[model samples]
Target: MMLRTIKRLSSRPVHILGLSTYNYSHNSTLSYRKLTTSASSQTIKREEQAETATVKKEEPDEEKPKLSTMLNLDRAQMEKDRLARLKRKKSDDSHVPQAKHIKTLATQTLTFKKEESVDPLPEPSTSRRGPFMTLRDLQERVASYVPRHTQYLDGVVKKTYVEGRERTPNDIKLEEVFQKDTLQTAVLSAYVWEFLWVLQKLNVGECDLVLVLHAKEDEMVHHYRRNLCNIPRTRLCFPNMSGNVNCMHSKLQLLFHLTYLRVVVPTANMTPYDWGEALGTGRSEGVMENSVFIIDFPELPKTSATPDSNPSHTHFSRQLLHFCKAKGLPADIIEKLDKVYDFSRSKPLGFVYSIGGSHHGTEALKNGVCGLATAVRDLGLKTKKPMEVDYVTSSIGSLNKEFLLRMFRALHGDDGKISVQGIPKKYSSRQLAEPAAAADESTESESEEEDQSDNKLWQDIRSSVRVYFPSRRTVAASKGGIQNGGTICFQRKWFNSSTFPQSLLHDCQSVRRGMLMHNKALLT
Candidate 1:
């Protein structure tokens, strides 16, 4: 026992929980030793108290001002204020029922205010980014900078003309332009107001409105009802659909009555808009597009020929009539197209279409573009500075080198001077600058020997290819918004063979320059 005690004295003594190692003070030791409550909380409180004491000793003492003293107020008045606050808080607790009643009344009154006066609605979907900006913010403020596209949706709805831009949507005043005895009209569009508004403005009291079957048709119709001053006597046409994937993407205003047919193809769901309107500040105006209002009437030939003289040379009006008939159009309109309109004489151009989404992928480019190309070739017009064919559009598709090769081939053929220029409103400004440098390099790199290869036509077409890109503004002073520059490129080259009758949809990685384009038109 004596030896063990000696050993214990010589060696180090071990405290429970290694408290001696921590060098805990007496207060800390007591706080941790308490078993009735959590040691952690007690220790924390002790530490806090010690820190607060230290802080108090270190702080300099100055004359602290009371709320009343700071404002040069009297103590009695400050006391009264404190008492009033307490009284107000006590009253608040007692009058809870009345306060609730007042809140309910306030809510009811607020319901009467116009909704637009309220905060803007939450974004419809987090997934969707805003439509692509085509210009830099700074460029938008440049009064003289020409835009590739114009923002004319406001004009379309207001039916007012904005200066320094394209003609108004109702520039010709369709109501005044067309003769009496209104035509049997067939309108294709996604927006009902765009369709109905134009029809009403044209004095079309009765007509057919064609819609691509969509899930939100019910809501859209409800909204359209609010837009219209009078409910139009409309015959709605939803083309026969086998699946949800396909839609009637074509936008056309086909009117026929009493030996005449007129076709108006506008971009953006036939919204009454000006094709030549100047792009405003901070709007998409990087590129230009082509558009036209097509009007044609059946002309009787001096030589006698039946309405269906040759299926090959069937007039544009007749072809339109055929398209309607194939779709099982309403009997009344069909009757008018069949009897009233003559289809003997040929027009300068006709509308071409693809039946399904797959059709756009294949036949649309071929038939539509190639047909135009063939027509251009037939024109035999000579120009020293290659003929400039333009495409102004809103929609683009996945285009690739091969598809472009095919297209250029179809358009250019042996004609070296044919240069195709496209300006999609979304990428107008940035793409405008692309063609100059890229085209020169690309054209220089290719060899003429390749002309003898299988893709001779494509090679020839690539020779004269050029695209346009515009200068983007960096910032906008008026809106304080960052508008991004535009870009263009194609993804796939699914098209291998050039088909006749091209449906020209703009597509490219290298974009082109344009001035206030966006009306869907093919101008040769």
Candidate 2:
């Protein structure tokens, strides 16, 4: 075809062809250029078609199905229907007896079957078996029984918190005593859940009941009316409460009868969690707490104890009486308490508690870092006696440098805070000093002679101003061999182990896996 086109162009005029072909040497040159142009155009068209096909392949116009198309959809549907039908048949056959004879009688009538009761969640364990004594075991060992010189009180010494065992609902024997003497009165501070559970457990049916309760009036509280209906017996109290922040935060359990009076100060609440019913999480995987129990076996039935005979009891009675009176106890309960324990007869023990109101917090703060001379006299530590202030607590955050020094100065007549974490490395020492300045001679003399009785066995406390707190290792470990009792542990540790105190402290190596702790307590 090219040759035919060249022949036809050859017959044309050279100048005419030259003008048409521009600068072509021959008409065949024009034919060859056309041929090359046509070939190049065809090649470009083929490349463009290839590029368009690749783009279309890379980008899908529509989405694909998620489930496998190869699956047997019909078979799966049939299987599901068959399972549903079998479930329905099972439900229908449930009423019919398995025996053929009994199945025939199913058309007559069948009684509804009752379901078995499901058990509630298990409670957390407060105490696990240990081969040796933790500070807790030592604390229990040192705590003395209350209502001494009485049949019940003496037997109670062994049954008290001395065993280092977890507290149980039935562990409290006061329940039986209260039930027996229907005239006995009992007062407790608790959360609603705890109160209800305790009330149910104690079996204290309307015999005198005074409760200091804490809990919000939520939907659950309304639903649990069987217990909430008895709200009349409780004097409502809450902490961080909207109406009142410091509204009766004290956890006191007082049982009063004409014959005797029992006092229990527990760090734990009435809830199962407090009594090791709820397992802890995170840092509190293992929990520990401190508690104090005082049984004032009144010198009733016949007068045995007197103002001087049992000064410790008298002092405790006075403090407790003051607390109750200030708490605005019921007139009847107050009257009953007065008949047994007379505050006038109580011996004075120097202990200033932190109470409600800004004034109290301020006073606590002021007392924290200052007023050493007065506290020394108040605590009845002979200014001349080598006495030092030792602070052993579960929560270290409760004390700081400025505050600790002030407390030590007040108790030991010196000043300083030590360096444990951010604390300084200086401790206050209580050297022989001049007489402590006190409010009155009567107050000084009153606090003086009583502590002597207990001190008869040992010398005065000479431990310096030292703050003990849980270490980082203790918090991380799951071991609960350390005492949660704040400063109380020091007294218990020393008092009980005066004979072999180190034995208890060292026992952790054999038992609790070593001195690991929580609750921030800095003890064995």
Candidate 3:
């Protein structure tokens, strides 16, 4: 194809191709030259045409200003254009409301039409009509089923009561002595969960609860956490027993009601077993029997005209208030007892409290063993010169000769006789009934007199006092048996001590056979 093209170009005239004759030496050279020249010219012509076409396609026929051009523009014109665009946009937007705006408008319209008004998503129902869903649902079910308040005599399921008269039973339920229909409760116990459970049974959950227990703070919180409803209303008080006191063993309850305040002093702990609730399954009789002393005080009249408004100067009332103060009770509750409640009814009652630490001087006459003497004296109870006192206790500490003598004297309202003649010189010197007898003997006759006096005192104590405790056999035979008798403790170390009055240890067994006795009573 190249040869044919070259031959064709060679036939053409030099003048037509616009090339000189001197440029070629031979016909072939001339033909090649002609082909080269003609081809080059044609390629150049095509290149120019392509460049022109591309330029025409890519470049605009006329240049237009950039939309954002502002180097030398008129400010007024730019502002005018911007304002016009905004006005047009506003008109467009006004024709169609936004989604949120439309929803708000619909809500307003429906709100005006009571019949067609939309309610919020309905609240979750509390009624048990639906299936059990959450734990709260189960709690509500349980609360509804359980009685809010129960009778103290409710445990006496064995005997039916007559309509007209109240039949007192040999064993009383813990709730029976509760400030009946109490508004609030303050419980002092050694146990936590069982006490809280007892409170639940008494329907005391509705009101505020002040729990003073000898339990760990975390344990108290854990127990109360089970009853989510009472958590807010319950307050736990752990006595500062970090001092001389070992534990908060006070078994007291202050039941506040609308009309009166009931003070309960019970030998029972705040446990179901102690409160007359039977232990183990299918047992109708309670494991232990306890005693309670309950006294009700009417609400003091608002007017000063009433004699009840004046706080009782009675020894019992003053001593009780003092005990409350010492225990760091709520100030408001103590005030209510002192001023808002009538203590005139409490006058005949005798109160005895044993504070832990040593009491000296005048304080000695109002606390511990001495306090018992004070109470007995204040009560004006008839007493023989040689009183035969029987002290029955479920929980007994180490018993010594000196302690028995002091106890005997307290019962006889003669706390002055706090010493034992034959005890160690150190202890005898501190609490000698006759300091002269403890002095150096000046003669053999004087020494004989001192010895005689000591002998007489020792004989008096032995004849007058009797301390009763449950024997191992007695505890084993009880309803709860040996296992549950852990609470009724008398350390082997104390029992084996040489000074222990083994002779005074009369076997204490409850009247109700097979039942343990938790009662602490003084039979004079």
What's the lDDT for candidate 1? 0.36
Worst 10 residues of 3 by lDDT: 1-10
Off by over 4 Å in 2: 1-183, 190-193, 214-227, 231-247, 277-289, 299-315, 342-352, 360-379, 384-390, 413-463, 479-524
Report the C-alpha lDDT of model 1 over 201-275, residue by residue, as the tens digit: 432332334433222355644544443323234545555444453455555555543334555554433333332
Residue lDDT tens for model 2, 424-450:
112111111223343234334433642
Highest-scoring model, TM-score: 3
When sorted by lDDT, best at the front, the candidate numbers are 3, 1, 2
Q: Mind giving the per-residue lDDT tens digits that candidate 3 earns over 1-524?
A: 01101111112211112111122223312121111222343453343244322322222111111111112223345345444543553454433222233235445644633332122212223333321134564354344431223222112122111111222453344434542233455545454335324543443324566767664355654554443332324676655565566666788778775455667777777767676665534355567767776666766667743433454446878898888877777777677777876676666767788766655546667777778877887788636476777888888787786676656656666533233122343343344333555443323354465456656767877777787888999998877789878778789999899998777788997666776777788888
- Tell me the TM-score of model 2: 0.43
Per lDDT, the best of the predicted structures is 3
By lDDT, is 1 or 3 better? 3
lDDT score of residue 350 within candidate 3: 73
TM-score of 3: 0.59
